[model samples]
Target: MTDERTYWFDTMQRIASPVLHSLANETLHSDLPTETPPLKPSALLEAFGRTICGLGPWLGATDIPENEKAVQAEFLDLYYRGLANGMRPESQDYMPIVGDHQPLVDMAFLADGILRGGDRMIDDMPEDVQDDFLYALQLTAQIKPYESNWVLFSVLVEIMRWKLDDPAYSQQKIDTLLQKMMQWYRGDGIYGDGQNVHVDYYNSYVIHPLLVDAVTYYSDAYTRSIRDVVYQRAARYAATLERVISPEGTFPVLGRSITYRFGAFHALAQAAWQHNLPENVAPSQVRAALTAVIQRTITATDMFDANGWLNIGFYGNQPTMGEGYINHGSVYLCNTVFLPLGLPVSDPFWADPAKDWTAKAIYGNAPVPRDEPVNY
Candidate 1:
């Protein structure tokens, strides 16, 4: 098999090996051994299940094989359990621990449900549940003065677009959300997740990637005026994220899920896919850099534990300071790390190793430069 095929297969196998095991024996909706743990609502347990379930079909899309039917079967079992127990069809139950996170939950369900689950999901959600879900989606329609973390908003937009089947379906909402998001960006490609520009991984993991996907989706449906603005902002974010990577190929593991480590590559790959990445922003270089990152933090034994949970933290076994409500499985959403799988294996960006600063200097190539930030 080609390297591309190898990557696709290896990634799927890695993800499914553990996930399939979890499905076979694990039960959902059990109370935490400790008090409510971070990331509230019993719904999240279900959401995690749905998210992994979504991954199976996506893996199958790449031809993982029918023998792997266990993946989807497990997804279906969890999804049904979620619908039957955790979710109430008539109520909107998406409250967050901090900042408004309902949209994230909504998008997660909608994206996983429609894109991956299809008829299975629709059937599982009774009519009342569907109506309630539509109501929950409408709740995300507001534009506010404060720039809350905009990643969830843009992600909601993608899910809405998928749900609505309109290329320009949620234009007004997208426009308003974008305008609000723009206020948080301090220029030179960096954006504060919300107000006051305290920096972290949001730029690489959420901000830049969401912008690229939302813009590309909207542009496909509407005029250049709408699309071009987002593209320009995305280009700048991509450039800045490139500079954040150290000469050693590591970016600072600051922010929420330091456990998520290389998960930020989703943003990098999205930005690259939206356009030809700048010479300074190397895709293969990023792939190699993040490979080092994933290797450093995750262990082969992470899949097996006394409690049957995966355990690896950004700062080793101990949990760090900023990880608010996240738990073990919540961290695995970091498996979103493989989201770049959406990019076809044949994409040229994946074909060659990117030249790092050392390579650039040695080979007489243009240096990858970082622009200083503008303090707001």
Candidate 2:
């Protein structure tokens, strides 16, 4: 495997192992560290759900090297057991799917994991665990999401139900939520988060990735046009993300949720993973750029506690960087950078020779194409 791929896989395992191991053993509640004791319950769900959301594609892929596949198989076992334990009321690690507004967000992450995990992860589920999974999703169905990007949460949950062929899935609700999201699109490949644009990474963190997945999954005659438009916008946003990465791989620490670390590039990673990168951006450049960001961010001192749980910080254990809504589990969203790991070793994303990203080329005085804004 290439060094970049190896780095990504090793990093993913490092971040995920502690959570999955503890949960699978039904000890997550006791093991997970939380900045706020009262928020531990929500944070546990955040860690598990968000980890799987990012790992899903890699976990589902069947074309990996034998060594990697063996490792993935081990994680798959832990993942299945973790799911069973997390959903079972009798299990010590049971993470409530129904509750306050927080579960609405993490449940969507869990649902996105299921979508990305695809049939390999879903089809092998134990019958009892499958029932519990469906039931837990049904519970989350009642959650009323916020007027903003939270709308996409509801859409993803419904999409998961649709993927499972559950009768509870509502096409009407999915269509309505999706339509609401489109209305919030502020143009130039950015969405307004709701009715107003926020100067944050929510576009990459939540809006574009989930929106693209929703439309792609629910594709039909009605959604075909919508899918094209959404992906076009996503590609544009992705290109912008690529350009912003500095020669050192650091991006502007802009807006809220900065503590999610490298997850700020979810759209760009997803574009490369899905072979949807804009015409001007090369897959190899994205690989190099993201690898640099991962190295810079994850290798920082104090990024993780003594026990391997991620601390609430952007660079290190800088608690001041966290918003009131941020917690230990919330930062696990950084795993989204591993999305491209879903690609097979032979895919251009992994196979192509590494190249300097746009920023690096410009900074080095290497000839590169002029940057332009997407007119759409």
Candidate 3:
């Protein structure tokens, strides 16, 4: 790799390594409002599992200690227990909760056990555990009738492949979801989070890549036609987002939980990894811009305690304003910063430290003239 490329990889490694290292030490308290109000441990488990899975690559054998394995094992064991405790589906406001969120929890664990982290835990699952997971998927198919968030629904399709691989898991529902989700597309790689037209980076960072990944996982059956269209547009959108960083290396910081500002880089990272980055897009530039944003938002004194509990609020120590859903362990969702784990070391993009994006072009690159106001 050239010195220029090496710079970007080094910078990304720096920005991500600390967050992954912090995971083992982060305090996970369950008595907090995040767990008390809704009183559902599965959501917390899902959030925690996703965080761990997102950060796992960085935490591989060499980075994390062998001693920490027991801790992580216990953490996962508790989450699995929660899934076992309430395997049935529920509904809310006439919408199927299975389609809305519960399935997401089921899929999160399923992915945690099989697809995302590998199938190491597959054989270890008790017979009853395997049966409950199947029952959960059956419930997932039943709830597909009234759901609208195509992203969450798409997860079930991937989980089906990973869990059952059965041709009987409802291809019709998957097709319906793809059709509905495509309706949210406004071109240039953006998809509305759900109904309506509120546009933001979350769609770019979370929704698009997740859908694309789901598309890729089922490539054996679904033709490449659908995946190609979404990937091309997503890469283009990532290219446009490259211009969002200021010459000073700052983003607009325009959405909810500015704490999640760093999480926005996950989409760009995936684009680079997939080798689908736009022609005009430079991985080095995305790295430099993203590194700058992390430095600005994730202050050592504010974002985490000495013990590693991610402090609430965007800039300071204020857990009071966090959602009723943010518990001690939930804060580690911030580890979504390391979503670049999917990228292999052999990838040219990760071979170097970050380079500059703000040098040649001034401040007018990827300007969003107007941002949609999100209801807090």
Candidate 4:
């Protein structure tokens, strides 16, 4: 039987391959079944964007067992083929940049996926393919995101532009997005998505992750200081997330995007992957906590369709949990929970023996230190 961590990465591949295979081969438009969708092409691309982002770190890793190398080798081939098809204006796989709305907003995630895998995927593309990929990504500029965390969408695309050495990249836009995130900071390790704080997971799912990633592209003293604050807050929030997991592996199915399931823990998983956990939160416990969550959520009945496509639901097919904006692809955001799987097996996060997470430590016989308030 595969261990939970291996299962997590495999699950990521299983969910991604069907969409990517057809897209790469130019059959996605014809072969993909458009179900429960408000928009077909956009939803399919969403599935691609969300899936590839999680695979980014894993695909970039140089160390993995032989089996993972095989899986990586296969998918990397599919990704390259699909990438070329997606970029060509005349190709059947050409993805439409419909409007300056959600279509382009989703493109930010596509940009993010490329950024994450750039060291591995983008760098290896043949010269012409590389130019095609960069041009396709830069085309996301046509859309204008809303005032909230959506601003990060545009920023992500622009940052990728800067990364590709796109001559038209704007430094002013990057600085503006950074300032906007600072304004949205609500203190106590949380951020209001945009103008108002909706009770949801977008902060962990998108905002801070992109914030930390963006600063690295153009590092300066001011950006470095802001990045530090972002890491500290994200660390604090990650600790809070660990306690939310129940001993039985269940959690409150709260707020919007409950269908996103364990993706709510993206920040916690990312913090652990980055080794940014607060001092009190041991890496072992986080691994344990996330493993339990991954097992519980992925095992949920009806999570995948008969053909292995991801359905929009939390546990089973609880479609009501999804918002009007959610389509089948939106749920793929759950892949972010597997971020820690990108770490090499020898890292303490994976190598350390299993330990009781915060909940289990406090409730069970394990000794845990007293909790301290995080002061920012």
Write down the TM-score of every candidate.
Answer: 0.67, 0.97, 0.68, 0.93
Over 4 Å off in model 4, which ranges?
Answer: 36-39
lDDT of 4: 0.77
Model 2 residue 261 CA deviation (Å) reads 0.2
Query: What is residue 313's positional error in candidate 1, in angstroms?
Result: 2.4
lDDT of 4 by residue, 238-291 (tens): 888888888878888878888888888888888888899988888988888887
Global lDDT of each model? 0.49, 0.88, 0.51, 0.77
lDDT score of residue 242 within candidate 3: 66
Question: Which digits, one per residue and each the tens of the lDDT, describe model 2 over residues 1-376?
Answer: 3877888888999998998899899988888887767555777789899999899999999888676988899999999999999888899888886657888899889889878878887888898888887788788889999999999999888888787779878888888888899998777898998899999999999999998898777765656769888999999999999999999989899999999999999889999999899888999999999999999887688999999889888898988999988888889899899998889999988898999999999989999997776767
TM-score, candidate number 2 = 0.97
lDDT of 3 by residue, 125-163 (tens): 566756666665655555433333445444544455446
Candidate No. with top lDDT: 2
Candidate 2 wrong stretches, greater than 4 Å: none
lDDT of 3: 0.51
Question: What is the number of residue pairs that collide in model 1?
Answer: 2
